[model samples]
Target: MATSKSKTSLREDLTCAICFELFKEPVMLGCMHHFCRRCIVSYWKSVRSPVTCPQCRQEFPNKCCFQTNYLVANLVEKVRASSSPASVKYLEKELNDCLESQCSMKDAYISMIRKDKDKMEKIKKTGAELQGRVHNDFQALHHFLQVEEEAMIEELKREQEEMLQGLERHLEALQVAIRDVEKNINILRQTAGSTDQSVLVELPKLNSRPISIDI
Candidate 1:
């Protein structure tokens, strides 16, 4: 294969400065500048007075003072022949295939990125919903537990109050019983001093009274 530099140099050598294409009928000016015959003629006709080389800007005395370069023309013909229609069509097809493949790859990458972003969003949404449900459940549980604790404490207080009232009533009853016993003791002391037969009769009645206390 020819190097890129050599190919570029060869193309530049065969190309006309005016039309910037491969020379149709190559011509040389007095300034040693090359152009297509029609291109140079048209350039001179469009300009005023003396003709100038398009590349070097060199002036020529005669307007039609350009010679047909047979060697350059032959080279141009050979270059044109070498780059046939079949070769040009093959190169075009290759370029089109490469561009199509690159576009398809780019589209595939874009699709993958879009799908991943959608999946990530779905994951975040689901996670947030689950968190909300958990928080609500914990709040409900806390409320229920608080209610249960308060009810239990109230029940304990009620039971404690009832027990304390019962104890107080029992103490009052015991105090009344103690006072009655003391009154009986004083009556016996007086009766023992007197040698009365009536007091001895009442002693039997006092012995008949029940002594066992019921709670």
Candidate 2:
């Protein structure tokens, strides 16, 4: 069984130099380089008296030998019939051969795996950086809320204290007025029990007196 490397080398060797295509009616020059019949003939007509090999540039006094390459032609036929059983067996042999050689599919697969691992590492690093940034942002936001909450609490306390002071002052004033009114009521009640005309007249004046209270 031929190796994949051998098959590739054979394919390269069978390719025509002038047309750079599959050898169509292949012919060999004096330098042993192969080219398509029409392609080489056309190239020679365009060049000067001495025709040269396109690959090696070796000049020949006259036109080089135009020998037919039946081996390359037959190989081309086998490669073209890829769906045939014979071609399939040949490809299988080449694949087996490539397994024994270096720089095969195994090495390529390992290289591909290494590349994906490196990519994953980069992705993980990026994810960590993003998470760290998000965490720091949340912490900053939480601290800001805490500061604002403290300031709000302080303002509430100050407002409540001011309200309490206002209420206390009003209550104190009301208490003092209650004590003064009670003292005057006791004095009037004693004066009314007297058998005097002046006492009765003063009682009517006390009833007419206007009372006021602080809001």
Candidate 3:
């Protein structure tokens, strides 16, 4: 393979830069640049002196500065003879194989990119769904807490009202008992100087009456 590539490179080197073809009647300029003899002559006729090499642009004194390069001419002839129909077919097959491999690689890269894009879309969709579910879950939790709070507060209020009512009833009973005690003390003050036997009987009746209070 390396030998074949070297021969191909050598053949390319023997091609004329001006005509882009295998060198015919190859000639070398003073600058060592090569071209076909007729190609350089025609190129020089189109330009003014001092003439310049087509490839390097190196100036020459005159067209006479160019001379036939017999060695390059012989190399070009040998390269032409070596390029048989079979070799041309082999080169074509190699080019087609390279093109097919490049196309397959391109397809593989495109498939990978497509798969990655799909995965990205899936990730985004799943994330959005999860976020929605989280939001809904939190909202439900908040609602439950709110309901529990309201219920607890309402229960506390009812219990407090019941306790206050019980206390008020107890206070009213204590007030009535105090009024009865004051009435008995007034009676005792009025009857004390007389020293009546009937007052002693009334004292027993007053003692028998009871004031009942419930917590």
The model with the greatest lDDT is: 3
Runs of candidate 1 exceeding 4 Å displacement: 1-95, 188-215
On residues 29-71, what C-alpha lDDT tens digit does candidate 2 reach at each position? 7677888889988898998876788788888777656788887
Each prediction's TM-score versus the true structure:
0.50, 0.47, 0.55
lDDT of 3: 0.88
The alpha-carbon root-mean-square deviation between model 1 and the true structure, to one decimal in Å, is 9.3
lDDT of 3 by residue, 1-215 (tens): 79789997998899999999999999999889999999999999998777899899999877889889999999998889769787778878998999999999999999999999999999999999999999999999999999999999999999999999988888887887888888778767766756566646554334224656566
Q: Candidate 3's error at 185, in angstroms?
A: 2.6
lDDT of 1 at 186: 76
Better model by lDDT: candidate 1 vs candidate 3? 3
> In what order do the candidates fall by TM-score, top score first?
3, 1, 2
**Candidate 3, clashing residue pairs?**
none
Worst 10 residues of 3 by lDDT: 201-210
